[model samples]
Target: MLIDIFHDTVCPWCRIGKKHLFDALAKWQEQEVHIRWHPFLLDDTVPAEGYEFRNFMQNRKGIKAEELQHLFDYTQREGEAAGVKLDFEKIRLAVNTKLAHQLIALAPTNIKNDVVEAIYRAYFEEGLNIGDINVIVAIGTAYQMNATELKLQLNDRDVVDAVVAESAFARLNGINSVPFFIMNNQVKVNGSHSVEVFLEALNSTALLDIPAKI
Candidate 1:
């Protein structure tokens, strides 16, 4: 089975949703599964330097700072339940994620998911500016990717266009949200679903291939 995940690095729910999907995979050991990550830029117009995280959320949601805290509190609890940490208070910027997505695209298949998680951890947990080229270069190098070559590729015009185009392709396909999943190119699930929902999708697809599993 193949799972294509459309997500932006800065989305807190996307991180939680990723954990849920992996949790389901842990139980569904009946078939080999491959995952492909795709970019879904939440706000593509964000400047390269990024926007102030608190103000951006407040304006985008039309909610007061305290009200936003309430929402974040709920999300934090949900993230904890999902075994993922989401420190909203620590975040300072809503970064332009095109470069981050490019790094994920450049990563080898085996280490791609790890690279994705590292980006999430850096932005959400450590409050690092992932939009910065130096930060991304460091991340790539930490994973044993060639630092100088990775830096060059990250700055290449073609790579930027490729990541941007991939994001556009998602919007063209009517996928305007993060954490969207397509299982076996048949099951379409949106939002941050529970582990059971993911398992249901996995089992349904697995049954099609191995009918006698029950």
Candidate 2:
């Protein structure tokens, strides 16, 4: 089965959703599955250097202090339930994830999933600024990708355009949220649903023409 996931690295729900998807897959009994990660920028207007997390939320997102606290508390509780530890305090910057998405697009198929996970952990867990070119290069090197080659690809216009186009296509298709999952390009699962919900979607998709491998 093929799973195409549209998500952003900065999205707390996306990270939690990924964890739930893994949990669902673990109990699926199907051993063979292919996943394709797609790009979706939550805020395309963020500058390359990025903004302080609190300022971004307050000024750009219009989130007041109490509302922000409520969001943090809610997401942290939800993350814990999904087996993901999200330290909102550790996150200092709200960055432009275009380059990070480009890196994922450039990743080799075998390591694409690893690259996505690493980016998410780097930003949400470690609080690294994934928008930085050097940081992105460092991540690629750590994942066994050639740093020089990856850096060059990251600066390529064609690569940037391709990822941008993907985001645009998603928006055109009425997908305005992150962590959207499409099963075999047919079944659409939106938001951070529970493991049981994902399992049900998977089971339903299996009944389609392409029987899921079990």
Candidate 3:
């Protein structure tokens, strides 16, 4: 089975969904499952320098202070339950994740999940600015990727365009949300579903002879 996950690095729910998917995989009897990561920019218009997290939420999303706090609190509780420790207060910047997605794209299929997990941990858990080239380089190096090559690729217009194109393809398919999962290109599951839900989908897809999408 091939699982293509359409998600953004900054999405807290995406992180949770990743954990749920992995948990399901751990219990799955099948050993031939392949997972692919696809980019979805939550805020594609964000500047390269990004914006202060609180200000962006308030000014752009029009979220008031109390309401924002409630939302963060709820998300943090859910994250903890999903084994993700997101430090909302420590996150100062809401970054543009195009570069991060490009870095993940550079990784081999086997290590792509590691790259994605590192990006999520740096942004949400450590509150690092993933949009910064230096920070992205450091994350790639820590994952044993070539730092100099990764830095050069990050600045390359072609690589950036590829990531943008992938996002466009996702939108063309009517995928407007993060954490969207497609199994074998025949079954689609959206949002941060439970581990049981993912397992059920995996099992069901294995048993069905659904025609592959064109």
Best by lDDT: 1
> What is each predicted model's overall lDDT from 0 to 1?
0.90, 0.89, 0.89
Model 1 agreement with the true structure over 56-169: per-residue lDDT tens digits: 999999999999999999999999999998998889888899989999999999999999999999987899999999999899898999998998899899999999899999
| lDDT for residue 146 in candidate 3, whole number 0-100 | 91
TM-scores for all candidates: the values are 0.96, 0.95, 0.95
lDDT of 1: 0.90
Model 3 worst lDDT run, 10 consecutive residues? 205-214
Q: Which residue ranges in model 2 land beyond 4 Å of their true spot?
A: 211-214
Tens-place lDDT digits, model 3, residues 90-160: 89998899989999998877788998999999999899999998988898888788988888888899999
Q: State the weakest 10-residue window (summed lDDT) of model 2.
A: 205-214
lDDT of 3 at 16: 95
Q: Which stretches of candidate 3 lie over 4 Å from their true place?
A: 209-214
* Backbone atom clashes (below 3 Å) for every candidate: 0, 0, 0
lDDT of 2 by residue, 117-187 (tens): 89988998899999999999999999899988888899999998898899999999999998999988889
Flag the better candidate by lDDT, 1 or 2.
1
